[model samples]
Target chain A: MQVATFLAYLVAAVLFITGIRRLRKPGTARSGNTIAAFGMVIALVATFLVVEVDAAWVWLLIGVGILLGGVLGAASAQMVPMTAMPQMVAAFNGVGGGCIALVALSEFYQGAAETWVAVISGLLTVVIGSVSFAGSIVAFTKLQELAFTGSVVFPLQQVLNALIFVGILLLSANVLADGAIVEAVGAPFLSPLVSLYILFAASLVLGVLFVIPIGGADMPIVISLLNAFTGLAAAASGFVLGNYALLIGGTLVGASGTILTRLMSGALGRPLGKIIFAGITATATQKGDQQEDREVHDASPGEVGEYLSEEANKIVIVPGYGLAVAQAQGPMHDLMETLESRGKEVLFGIHPVAGRMPGHMNVLLTEAGVPYDKLYDLEDINPEFDDTDAAIIVGANDVVNPAANDPEQDTPISGMPILEVEKAKRVIFVKRSLSPGFAGVDNPLFYDTEKTMMLFSDAKQGLQEVVEAVKSA
Target chain B: MEQLLVQLAIFIIAAFLGFELISRVPNLLHTPLMSATNAIHGIVLVGAIIVFATADDTFTIVVGFIAIVLGAMNVIGGFWVTNRMLGMFRPPVKRVRKRKG
Candidate 1:
């Protein structure tokens, strides 16, 4: 039995590693997911075999849980739109954290409490799991558009949080000391119930306070950070349960989440702290500054196509959620291929938080078989916009909006990070209509005159037509 | 050995089915699922505490107490945090004012 359990654990660990590796590449993500699921199956089987539960009622409870959870999980995936995927990821992480925490609690209850080690492990699980659960829920709500995703600062919010955290530590010492005193004095220890409740409350409040200051624009970073928190909680729970497989899995998740957070922060040209605490939007506004009016350019789709074929030195494609909604990746890839064949320098400008999730644009582009190297994050490609002959904005709105820098816009999205597409010599926007973005703000870039063209149609169909036109040319 | 293998298989299969089913739900249902699970954890905590307070065996009693506390923390902490986070996602309502010339 032990040998089989070890073998299963080994297999599961290998699968997890492979799945994580495959997750880095967009083409293999689905396969990676399947592999991870398979690993989880092995782990679950091993766990059931090793854990002793004598009660028949326990088995019945487990059966009920499985049935209930299964139904709920299936319903979520089918109903959630791609636009709300980030929130979904956050919610899933919370579930994972909650599961591990429960497992730890079960283990603690089944073990001898005399061991200081077990008590410490239980405490660790409570702290980390509580934080992860609360933090992830906050992240999910923000991503779901159900609540404000921006920074909310009450005076001394950080200071108050720190004080509360200190209070939790003090309470923890009392609990631990009481346990020791009971053993030393041959008396019953005070119930840890009060301390547990207090600790849990403090951690929960801290999680919300920690995430509330993070703005919507930095959701990718927040999501990554919360993922790391979940991983840490899982690892702590694994320790409490003395589960090797759990430890390995949790460590991997924690490490990956941290690395992803750092990479995202770097991509946004900001530190992790700033990403977490900076309430500034992608575009920053200055006080007492008048909105500058610039000459605006407008052109028909055909004329823009002609300009691309005739005079553009280089072209950069900016894709957004609209591209995903319209299923335009295939057509866009074909258009890029045509442009490259014409000896045009074509690159893609990918914003960090473009679309609903981090790397969403990159995932779509990679699915279309666009070379990984050609995809440039905002910081990497911002400088190139100046020398580029034409910037093709496709289905993207807030990221490419010039109003991010326009001081007088008074829009909620003003002072947020946005691609400086206007800096490009010629700008062409492809859209079905002049609809506002998710934030419901009009983009002044639509009216930019230096060299602007509006190609009206669904992104997929428009790109297909452009591909054909370029092919014929 | 065969019985153990069978049990393991059953557990794995059930877990897989459960995960697959849960993953398919809509966004709105996630919180409700979490809330329900939290309630279960609370029940588990209460059961553990009762066992600990009444059990004759010292080791079992100690273990039960630990489990109870940890389970309680999970239940209370999870729900409290989720609610606070949900608060952040609420959209601001605009107030309309009458024009006074």
Candidate 2:
């Protein structure tokens, strides 16, 4: 039975690797998911078989928990739209953290931490798991569009975060030291429960503060960070429980989440640490005087369509988060097809942080039946924007801003890489209004009359009208 | 210390293995890949099941119950949602399946 259980775990681990590998391509990704789910089922069944349980109430609790989880899980997946996938991901990952924290706490109650290794691991789980849970909840809220999605900055926010980090470490060190040496002296060394609770509370507070000032578009970074935290926490839970599956599985998640974080931050033309530590949006508003406003010409969709119907070498469409919200990808694709049919070369240029999630615009455009080859990432397409005849920006602001290109001013997004749509001979912005983007910085591209024009309308409406006008022209 | 060594070995091996495994995913499939990995990590459910099954006290039972609930939810919701998102990425020809009206 022992050998069989270990074999099951081993198989599950292999399957997880296989699943992730197959997820690279659209053709095999679905099967990869199924295989991984099967592995999970086997791991779970083996775990239940190996653990000795005779009590009927415990069995009852386990059954009830599974039933409740199954119902809620199915309901959420069926109900939550893909647009809300970010929030759902945040919320579910948060639950994983909360669950792991509970596992650590319960093991502590069961005296599983009799050894120093176990004691330290248990405390680590409690701290990291609590933070992941709290941070994920904040990320979920920021993405859910429930209320304000803007940054909530305050005086000395970094100082407060540092203080909280120090507080968490001091509390954790005290608990572990008490469990290790002070217990030998036998003077009611420490209430493990009290210290654990206080530690969890402080970590939870830190998680909130850590994510509170982050704006909506940056939630992807926070979600990735929290996901990594939960992974390490789960591994720590493994140490508490002496379970190899938990340890291995959790570490895999931690490492992968970390890699994804670096990839996402790089895509946005910022370092991972900068996105997390510096609330650039908050500070940029304080130094907003540099953007001297200039009047922009308002062009009708008919005029833009006439321009597209005319002789143009190349046109690039840059879609951002607003494209997702407006459900305009389909019409945008129609416009692209129309443009192509009229003997014009049309391509898409995507900024790394163009959408709320990593690969947000890519997945969205692909779902709208756009081919992979036409969609060029920032580096590949940045040079082409200058040679292009026109660049139509659909409800995006900061990614195309010239501010990122200008390094002398030291603006919040100064070092960030942006789509040089302004370099195009003629640029058109399709937006509902002239509002500042999530970065809260003015985009000079919208105000430049010689090279830029604003099509002040909904993305879908603008695209549809433009497509119709092109057909008529 | 020996036990911790095994744990550390498992940790490093899994990290390298995961990085190698997931690095090939195309940018277009990133959303699905993320959701899929999220489901894979929901393997935490196994730990919750073990804890809940072995727990003795009422408080432990309560904690185990909550953990199991959350773990199961994470696994189920994550996999289902990932599948739904990936379902949207079918090629143009086969994207439209026949509907029984």
Candidate with top DockQ is 2
* Worst 10-residue lDDT window, candidate 1 chain A: A281-290
**Docking verdict class for candidate 2:** medium
Q: In angstroms, give how far residue A240 of model 2 lies from its true place.
A: 2.0
Which candidate gets the maximum TM-score versus the true structure?
A: 2
Could you give candidate 1's per-residue lDDT for residues B1-101 as a string of tens digits?
A: 45434433533542343233332222222232332222222222323333343344555544444444443343344333333323222221111112322
- DockQ scores of the candidates: 0.03, 0.58
Give the best candidate by lDDT.
2
| Candidate 1 to truth, TM | 0.67
Tens-place lDDT per residue, model 2, A1-473, is 38888888889888877887788787788888888888888888888879888877777778889889978987998898666778898988899888888888888777778888888889888888888899899888888866446777888877778887886776677677664433554545656667677788888888888788877767887788788788888878887777877887788788887777777766666667766775533564554764545578889988888887884669999998888899999999999889888888898998877777867777778778887567888888989977899999998988888977776666567778888888788998999988877766778777777777789999999899999988998
lDDT of 1 by residue, A396-447 (tens): 8888877767886776556667889889997888888777666667777677
Model 1 regions more than 4 Å off: A1-3, A26-30, A105-113, A179-190, A278-293, A309-314, A321-347, A364-388, A395-425, A430-448, A452-473, B1-101
Q: Score residue A52 of candidate 1 by CA lDDT.
A: 61
